[model samples]
Target: MEISSQIPWSTIAAVISWYSSNIGVLLLNKYLLTNYGFAYPVFLTLCHMTACSVLSYIAVSVMDVVPFQSIQSRTQLVKICGLSVVFCFSVVCGNISLKYIPVSFNQAIGATTPFFTAVFAYLVSRKREAWITYGTLVPVVAGVIIATGGEPSFHLFGFLICVSATAARAFKSVLQGILLSSEGEKLNSMNLLMYMAPIAMVVLLPAAILMEDKVIWITIEIARNDIRVVWLLLFSSSLAFFVNLTNFLVTKHTSPLTLQVLGNAKGAVAVGVSILVFKNPVSVVGMMGYGLTVIGVILYTETKKRYRL
Candidate 1:
């Protein structure tokens, strides 16, 4: 297909929406992380999933869109559930990392997700990557190490969690791509969000209830007192649904590598917002790492001549 023909307006709109939502999510997530604790993850996830599910249900009902249906098979249901579990864990770890690290650093480090995704795609799907893609990882990795000042003493556990989260995110993208491609249909973000939100909510609800010190009733009471929390919850929920949906649309429109590159840009945007809006601290080393990461990403993009599934 021609380049213009390949570009889907819906995908473009989804990506723009994703970026806008990321800004809101980063701001709200930073507040929750700095002020509250990991509990914010559970709360944010539940709120967003619930809101998206409700909205999706309304849209489907009003518009007479695709009806709620079972997965094509039991195996598919199992895979979706498994992927959702991994997604939940990844997001939780990512949220936890924000407490110990600057948003920019987190985004910069997380940029490695594209590299990891490319590698994982190669290994898992037997897809071949351009030789330059491997070379591009060197600077990306170097930048992350330098950006963190090679510090061994600063929130080692948090850093590790973030790294693991990035890896899991990369894996999730690859798995999502495989599943979506196998299905062989262009699914709108709202449709996919409708299915995944309720399922993920079901999976996460039990754990949030059991592990969270605050019960549902108590949490609701607290939310009543802290109206900002309620607003944040709503914003976060909308953002989650939009972001994931845009990501899927982008993957369908462009190549996985392209989507990964865009993801890195999203991270950088988050970093910028964290510093400017939240007054988060940054180091000279972190700045250098950020610069190098941009350079590496540019190199990868230039060298990449083809976009494949």
Candidate 2:
């Protein structure tokens, strides 16, 4: 399918917007976690959730981006709660992964998300893709394996959490597609976020309090000592809010597969930026690995498009 012929300019704009926020948040959060010494992943995630909640409220109840709709059915409420669990799990794990690993390595692991997504999708829906499409995923998996050998900083625990994070993210997307596609319970991104943000916030609070509240107090003192920390954090939170906006916009305009493909491409961009900004060393082998992953991503996009998988 020739996407250009069918997708409206509005959709293209949304894709660009999502890309910007996704990339921006990755870089910003990494800076905060690694360089700036703001080591509160769960709490930081809560901040993002809180900001998204506030912004979503303003967008809906105040601005009327999409009319506020309440969840009336117990069934729908159950579904959203289930999604919230996965969503919160994925996001927290992601933040935790980034905290312990280099941004490039973190994103390299993340590039494998589509494979997990495909697996979860097939398992959940029992819908099969063409064998060729399945074949295309091999390169994606291979690339991640190759990259692992060359990772400059590989923490085993961090890598494990990141893997779980990737899987959870895939699960969330698959569930979102299944649960939200129903017309009767359908919600635009803002409305979806409005409900989801609160649930995620609730789910994350105990974790934040238990795991981070004590350790995070140190960061509070540090922030007080250096006011720039506060400014940077607030900036990060603001960007985090916009990320939800762009995330919904892209999914509204495109398929989860498209978003997955774009996310893979964004990983390459993120790794390049992280290396330049952080002055991190990338060996020849590592460069080759990164290149392989990106090539696989490109191939996957083409195969998915041509086969309409």
In terms of lDDT, model 2 sits at 0.82
Identify the candidate with maximal TM-score. Answer: 2
lDDT of 1 by residue, 97-144 (tens): 877776777787787776788788889998877676668878888888
Model 2 TM-score on a 0 to 1 scale: 0.88
Stretch of 10 with least lDDT, candidate 2: 300-309
lDDT of each: 0.71, 0.82
- Model 2, 185-269: lDDT tens digits are 9877788888999999999888988987675677678877898877887877888878888877787778877786777767778
User: Cα RMSDs of all predictions?
Assistant: 4.5, 3.4
lDDT value for candidate 1?
A: 0.71
User: How many collisions per candidate?
Assistant: 1, 0
Clashing pairs in 2: none
On lDDT, the candidate that comes out on top is 2
Q: Residue 62 lDDT in model 1?
A: 65
